[model samples]
Target: MFKRIFNNQQPISLKWKWGILLFVTLTLFGFFSSLIYQQNALNIQLNQIQANHQYFFEAAINYLESMDEPIQRTHFQSVLDEANNNDLNNTHDSTLEFLTYFESNDIVYRFFNEKQQLVYETQHINLNPVEYSDSLKRMDVNNQMALVGSTKIISENTGESVGSFQYIVMPQLFDDIKSQMQNNLYVILIGIILFALAISFLLIRLFLRPLTYLVNSLDLVEAESLSQLRVRKPRSTDEWSDLSDHINRLLDKIDNYVKHQKQFVEDVSHELRTPVAIVEGHLTMLNRWGKEDPEILEESISASLQEITRMKGLVQEMLDLMRADHVDIDYKDEITEVYSTIRQVFNNFVMLYPEFQFYLDIESDPDELYVKVFRNHFEQIFIILLDNAVKYSTDRKEIHVALSTSVTAIRVAVQDFGEGMSVEDKDRVFGRFYRVDKARSRDKGGNGLGLSIAQQLVKSYRGEIWADSVLHHGSIFYVEFPILSDTRQIYKSKQIAKHKSL
Candidate 1:
């Protein structure tokens, strides 16, 4: 039974668990508290019995010493009657409690001469002989717990022992008080445990209500409803509300990723279909009749090989796109100086297109501008823009490259006097497999993924990329990255280590 209740896999409700814990804790506390209270109460009663017994012993001894006759039982009775009447008539409330043992036979005493002959005693109880002590001792007498004390009676005149006095106080009032307290303690503990359990259950449920709602909301979410479903946030600004917000944000990302995956598959399939069909047509022609004629066979084989090359290039670019999506993870803690990389790529481009006019502009402090990007990937961003500029240039054949900086960012611009784009094309130029002029783009050997790859790479580095163009006039593509500062010198150190490893 204990194993089942505590099993981790088959967990119980938090409210009941807390309730049980509180119940046990409070029960133990109440039990110990009752024990302490009962002990104190019994001690107080015992002390009072001892004090009254001492008073009687002294009074009886004084009465015997005052007499000119020998001590007798009658003299002790007179002392007891006088003590009772005196306590009854006392106006002070303090002395009134002395009447319980004084007025009744509940307190019995025995007096013996120094030779051990009994001189006086009450007949109700026969207490066994006990050694004399300063404090009263509790012991069983006649099957009842009693306060017992023995003391020597001394003569005031000579300071000599005349007799010995012993007392056995049943203290029925003390016994009755103990019994009542025991019963009351049991009732109080049971009531306290029950009340504590109830309160704990209520409090636990109240505190966990938000979590319960969150769990229920999560249960309702299905893959199909991800885009439309949202967890309801609590009104209070607490950890539970923060949790709801995080879950909602996570769902949004999942929905977007699913949509992007679907679009990526569709775009790849559509792009592949045309080339696949071209290859298929050529193969079918060669098998049917083109194989018989050398010219036709050569033409079919050339077209098929060209299409196959294009397909291979498409596959390679798709792989690059995939890598661009994970650039942050693949190239973590990478940093580069802006000027050196730009100069190198520009010089290469100038050498490749020596006939075309090229211009370089540097508006920022090139030595000071640094950004967080792998040197190779950083160079790739500019290469794509420059190559696009070269591919789409008009008769002017002039390209411009500029490096500048803002307070927070390093900016690079690549401008070309090319066959520019319409507004619709400009808006969608960074979309996967998009092109303004499809036939012209294919004729120029453009797969339309260059700008998309650049965009993804820039976004992965927490940067931005965009283009502005006028139809038939020209286009300017811009890239921006946040510059690293003194506080982030750690990245530079990391870059040094990375280069050493390489």
Candidate 2:
């Protein structure tokens, strides 16, 4: 499970982001280290000098004391050489070595005693300085000058003067000093680079995370629907939030456009075909008989007239349907006389197809049985359903239409014992231009817009239409509309025009 969760499809950006982070970290560390190295080097040199001052002072004093004691020249020279070299041969160095170690960077040596001056002064001269002045200055209480009294010439072993001994010290730059500093700075720089890279990688990951989420989310999605492509968003006040909003808006526009395109096609087909059929139908009828045959001409003319009628109905229904879609109807709604409307529509349907059996069950009086509806809308609804029943009935079969009241609304059910529709056909029956028996509908001369227009008109008055059917069994269409009271004033308004006509 963990392996699957961390799949091997890491984004290219993640690697590059982390790489840049490392580079910046290393650069920063290097910069700081270089800064400290120069300072630390100066401090180290200062420490060395302070330490040398103490050691060198002791070494100078010891050389002065040795010269003060008279000693044999050769024997004294050997002891002075040991002190100057700072290399005592015992397990530990002697006190002389510790004293002379201060002058290790320069030269330190002890000469033969001053009493042996006869030969030594002629043979040896110490390095550095114009001279180790025989009268070097010292301070008195009144700042008066005096000779450095301890450095005076002395005897050898017999306490006779040989010569004066001197100790010299100088400063030298250590050969590896710069190299050590450079090495320290180099390690610091590397460490800085690594640290910077880590931080930079993290920042890049954070900045691009929303975009990456959108991309990875798309990868995981396995769908073509608009809803499926929606990505979860980050909760940050940043540019990423703006981008997410834009993406969602784009998807919404795409979905709306697709829906409109489908509707446009359906509307165009429903609107255009009826007129085209009328024209072609008339032309075909004339071509078949050429106006010479009277009977054929009558039949052709009648057929053309029927087509024209159907086309006119299609145009009117189109206008009504569009209005219903785009505008709210403001006409009055009330507990209309649903039974009377059914009786009237059923009579018209049977008059048009008298061979068919039609019956109604209006179980309530007009006052008690009202469906809140616009009269024109109910009329159209009644016509469309009855027309469909008559058209689809194969054996001129019976139609069962019943009107009843529910607690909140009225239901007017019309059942046709005809060549019934399939479950699929019933589902989309109200969609524009959808026809189950296309051949029959076309021959009967309909543009396939009646049921859709009826549905739209019904909904304009806040009603519902649905159908139930099996393949072989007959179909039943149920239309439910609102019920309303306060009919006394409405009855007076309805009777005014009728009374005037009478």
Per-residue lDDT of candidate 1, residues 1-502 (tens digit): 4687767667786666776787677778877877788688767866776687667755544554543333455665555665567754543332123333344556666677777667766645666678986456778876777777776766667767777767667757567767887887788778877877777678778778887887777787754377888888888999988999999999898888888778989998999999999999999999988888999899989999999999999999899898998889977777877898999999999999987899999985544467888888899899999999998997989999998888889899999998999999999999889988889889988898888889999999999999999999999999999988865575565767678899
Q: What is the C-alpha local distance difference test score of each model?
A: 0.79, 0.64
Taking the tens digit of each residue's C-alpha lDDT, what string does model 2 give over 185-248? 6777676766676666777777777878888766754556665577666788678888888877
Best by TM-score: 1
Error (Å) of candidate 1 at residue 147 is: 5.7
> Candidate 1 clash total?
0
TM-score for each of the candidates? 0.75, 0.44
Q: How well does model 1 score by local distance difference test?
A: 0.79
Q: Where in model 2 is the C-alpha error above 4 Å? A: 1-261, 264-267, 270-307, 332-335, 486-502
Whole-structure CA lDDT of model 2 = 0.64
